[model samples]
Target chain A: MNKIFETPLYAYSRSPDQESEVAVRHKIVIVGAGPIGLAAAIDLAQNDIPVVVLDDNDKVSSGSRAICFAKRPLEILDRLGCGDAMVDKGVEWDLGKVFFKEREIYQFNFLAETGSKRPAFINLQQYYFEEYLVARVRELQAEGKAIEIRGGNKVSAIGVHDDHVVLEIDTSEGPYNIETDWLIACDGANSTTRQMMGMDFGGRVFEDHFLVADVIMEADFPTERWFWFDPPFNRGQSALLHKQPDNVWRIDFQLGWDIDREEELKPENIDKHLRAMLGAEVEYELEWSSIYTFQCRRMEQFHKGRVIFAGDAAHQVSPFGARGANSGIQDTDNLIWKLKLVLEGSAPESLLDSYDYERIHGADENIVNSTRSTDFITPNSEMSRVLRDAVLDLAEEHDFARPLVNSGRLSVPCTYDDSPLNTADGLDGPEISRPGSTCPDAPFGDGFLLNELGDKFVLLTIDADAPELVEEDGIAVTRLEISAKDDTSGAIRRRYLGNEPTAVYLIRPDQHVAARRPNYNENLMRAAIRRATGKE
Target chain B: MSDLILTTNIDHADDFYAALLGAHEGLSKADSDALNARLVLILANHIGDNDILSKAIDAAKSSG
Candidate 1:
């Protein structure tokens, strides 16, 4: 057993609010101290917003779930001060190989370009990921940042009010009531908050199950993603292998729908499957094993009045693309800044609707990709299987067929193509860095570009002049000026500037571009800032 | 003008049909279906035009 799960990091304790005569009101109350909830708490606390996180469990997740962390979320974690520890402990890899039968068909590298701060993806167990986040929470608490994570505080009931939300929490001491100005539900896919609120989560439930086994063993397999389709050991089904830290390897075997849950979960049965895949002589211990049936679904709206949903509470996708936790981290990234503005009265509450709009777009994109990957991995019909196998057969020899092969598209940041907040394109810059796109990280002087952006709105000028500070609707936008000539690697030029000699970009707090122009204009910059903050 | 050559463009239509049938002469029903699927994919790749492929699909569906 893993030692992290045995030790309680945030054990239950009595709180002053538990003994109060009246239900104490907090600024924000986040439910389920998973990756998403902890990230939201850390982000809100970093911005000086008081937040309290409630979780039913005190320890990290028992199993090594959600093993792949993409680059964008790593960058978001960097802003929250937890990226360094995670990256140091994670197994970084960008290459993935797809196999058909006994032979390799094709391989892909996610990050072929250079100058990015983080890799395309990293494999770190969810327990370590949560531990690092909890460590960051403790650091912030030490700094007197108003943040609290109460373990064993399970929210049993919720009352929605126009201005605030009231929560009934069950604790070891007793049941206590608390109120908050707002509620952010980061509770995972089986969200109790979502069920209690009676929000409808609608989507397709795939008809297949997958057995995930985390085996601790010493193996010489390279640190890369290896996916097999119809292998000898697992005939007519797909399998996946990934390396994690501490010599733990994650193996996923596609188990058909009609499987005996109890029989398959037996240790001897799991060991038999492992022996077949890893050969009889390879020594390994089954650290964790479980069967899961994934669904691609989401609520219609992320927020209803004072209660808001983020992460798995808001949406869910098949785990094939690593979109589950990565997108959940992005939810907090897109949400916390807007929440801060609303809390400070700097922006209207309606700005949060854009969170629903943009994140729904993101969720739909993930669902489509995840559904496609699932369909390819587990073909439903005879014709679908024939076509899928045909593609794999041709992919081994043809370069064009390689693109047709589907083995989890992998997680990537979604560009808000039709976001309401985006100002019309005013510059002929690179399409990849256009309005409504996350700013691509490039190597700047001594550091990366995203590191300099931090967590605030900024006017990034490249060989263009802009005011040092621009105030719009009580929101301050600072300027970060750089010259195109100083770019030694030309990554900035290729990513941000395309044949444009100078560029001025208004970047949102989440590092997404609000607007961009060839040169700065005071009225246009202010208007972009207003639109981005929902003051327009 | 459409990219898909709907009009007959094969120099020897009977020869092409014979070759297509000859490829699956000794296959079972399942193997024949698999061969047809692979052949469609190969020809689709050779054509390499989405609009043409979509039109061909419509034509095939209507014909069936």
Candidate 2:
């Protein structure tokens, strides 16, 4: 078994705030040192914003909870300076095979195209993911970035004000008080911060339970996702198997609604199921086992006054699509830049409302996809089962039925369509890179397009004339010029330019497209900058 | 105008109905339901157009 979780990477330490005469105030306080909170702290600190993260626990997550890291989050982590470590340590695979009744129905390759830097998905233990984020936080701290993570500091109470929020944190020594201009809740699904605020997290709750067992084993199974429906071993239920790093395999078994949880989670019972699935000859040791029932829910609004909610604190989705932490990372990616702008007074506080609007959009997309996948996997009604089984049966021989099979749709980046921050698109560019879509990465110069854009509002002009710098309403927009002739693979042209010879795109600080045109206009570009920053 | 032809498009309608019924001749209720589900999926794929398929579903519901 891996010993990383047994050690405290962020062991509790006494801070000056605990011994202060009065409550100390900070620019921003993030509650929870999980993936989202740490990523938010790193992003804000990289932007020169002082942020503090508080959590009750001192170690990384105990089990390999969330195992799949999608490409978009990997890109976001790259911006946060920890992507290389994750990808290097993670098991990368794009192929997924679906099985029904001991026969392979169909297979899919998630990354069918080329020129992107990251793979479609990587399977790394969630503990390793958190450890990398914490390591990045340490590096930023060493570089004099204003980021502090206080372990064993739990927020027991919260008070919301019009201007700032006050938190009562309980430490090992005693309870202390602190104030923050902004409060970000990166706490998990059962968020104490959210409970203190009395916010509503409403959505559908799936009635089925899933057992996840992380086993340390030496198996020759290829590094691909394998999902089975109605297999002979686990007769009626579904099963999922994925390869994580360090010779660890994560297996999930769908146990029906009315089973004895404690009895089923027994080591003997789990061993029996594993022996049946892996055949009697296989050898393995159980590293961690958990039985989880999930709900696809979110708060009505992510931003409530001075207090903002993010990650599992704001929304919870079924684990089928791997949306939980992936979308949480995206939540912070959509939030920190806006919070930074609000703090710097470059944009109005209402600009943060767009965060509520956009991440809710992302949360809804995740909820819908996950709910559908859950219904397909664990059909509630007899007719639903009949149709689901029909799809599976036909999928064995028919190509059209393959798409109907939904083991899990997998996580993909959300496009903020109809976003209030997006300016009207003027160019007939590729629909995938239109206004309100995440910028597709392409080979640019020596690196990728996303690397070139970095964390800034960029005017990406391809064979188009645009000034190097454009400042509108105190927001600086830099230019990244690329000629179509220089793109050797033509990926840039296909992804960004479409059929247009020259195109200009206004990309946001979060690397989402804000506006685009075939030719750059000074007045229009300035208005776009204003609209993108919520000055409109 | 809806793309789904609600009018009498099948020339041998009676024969087609006979064949549809003939497909589920000797199956139990569960097997018949599964067969019907598969038939719906197959014919839906053959139709391919979501709009027409949706209209056909509406028509089937209203007729039922």
Candidate 3:
């Protein structure tokens, strides 16, 4: 083993090592050891770039918030070598039931029509998920990757001079100075870095407060998502129940804005709510519980000088659609690739700007959608509740109301309509044909699926009719043909192009459509690749 | 002020990446803007010196 790997710190000094403190700048500095920051470190360090992670947190929080993982983030976890562990530990759920006044209103099976190795979503506590990520970071460090993790180190100040970012870091011992080429602040919604930079965080903090509890149950219950609306005892209250591993279930109660924060968090109060939801017959012990308020807000900018933000640092969405952490991870996914390209000299620094462009749109979209969901689920006004209940009643039986009953909005991926990398037919296409939307799965050659075509840029053309475009200089492309009637191909055609596209379509590595043409031409095709990759 | 697009409309490869930078300028998310600039400078430092990006930072200060 290398001397550096054997000893991460240059020396174990009681006082700050003065000689070793000669502005030892790293290629990148990451703030916060959360999923987004850690993912950024893993990707950058793997590519041989020097990285240092800073966090004020001495230990991972035991808070069991954010209990769901969507498909896109699973792909990212797969890339970082933690996907298998996540899948093993997480409970896959494709079926969810919505209840209105103690009756099932409508049910939807996520696995009903699609076939893929990745389910629609999985349920797992965020803290355990963090442990899995930390393990991967440790493995990478053992291999002499230039990734450094420093916990309990508060970033006291941030100053971006034209040449580098100078950070004032407070350690257990004393305050010290660390210089970095660039900084990423994944420090979360209450980002001290953002505040230091003097950026505006504009949004509304809703009047409603929710009590989230992770409980260990003694009674047997079906493994399904049980969401209740307007229960009898807690008038104008709602509850969310999902089974976690080890006979534990995460439950949430909509305890309107008026309750005392401390009293509501008490174990007795939490147990009372759980028993009320589960009925007194079902005995349970409390594992963990916290009272949190939901907010619909976003930062004015994700980037300022050498410091960038991701996850909660960038935006905070109410947790209705499970967009908070998932969206942040997507930001990491979007930024990491561009950062890699810039570090490797394959792309310019400007490429990093798209991270802000792409992800902010995602956060904005999430806030709007999730806020709407919060309103529908927990209507503030009596008239609105009456209207909602009436709608739920209609949703139970009327076939016409079924689709309306299922807003089908939560599962819908946020569209990046404004991405500079977006093509003319980009995110604007119908959900199926949307270029900037998640690439739909379809059968390609000899039974290999379209999603199998993920992991690299793919240019698919329906026409075996058009001659293959010569592979461009720095882009990946593929072309194939299948009859419209082919089942797998039919599904793909239905999902993506609405109908099978006549010409050519290019998909980005993240599975969003980059470009499409009515007919395939080498120059036009190459142009699309250049545009998406920012060569033009 | 509006949604940030991840894909570019430009057909040329060079222009597509250029659009990525250009689009970031129009981003509305507060965190997205600050983080985007930070990533650009950080990535730029990995490639070259702190000259251009540093100048941009200085310019931002004057404008603010």
Full-model lDDT for every candidate: 0.90, 0.89, 0.69
What residue runs in model 2 are displaced by over 4 Å at the alpha carbon?
A: B1-64
Candidate 1 on A109-226: residue-level lDDT in tens?
8754589898888899999999999999999999999999999999999999999999999988889999999999999999999999999999999999899999999999998899
TM-scores of chain B, in order: 0.89, 0.82, 0.33
TM-score, each model? Answer: 0.91, 0.91, 0.78
Quickly count the clashes in candidate 2. Answer: 0
Docking class of 3: incorrect
Worst window of 10 by summed lDDT in candidate 2 chain A:
A394-403
Residue A61 in candidate 3, Cα distance off native in Å:
3.0
Task: Output DockQ, candidate 1.
Answer: 0.05
Clashing pairs in 2: none
Better-scoring candidate (TM-score), 2 or 3: 2
Q: How much is the lDDT of residue A104 in candidate 1?
A: 79
lDDT of 3 at A158: 83
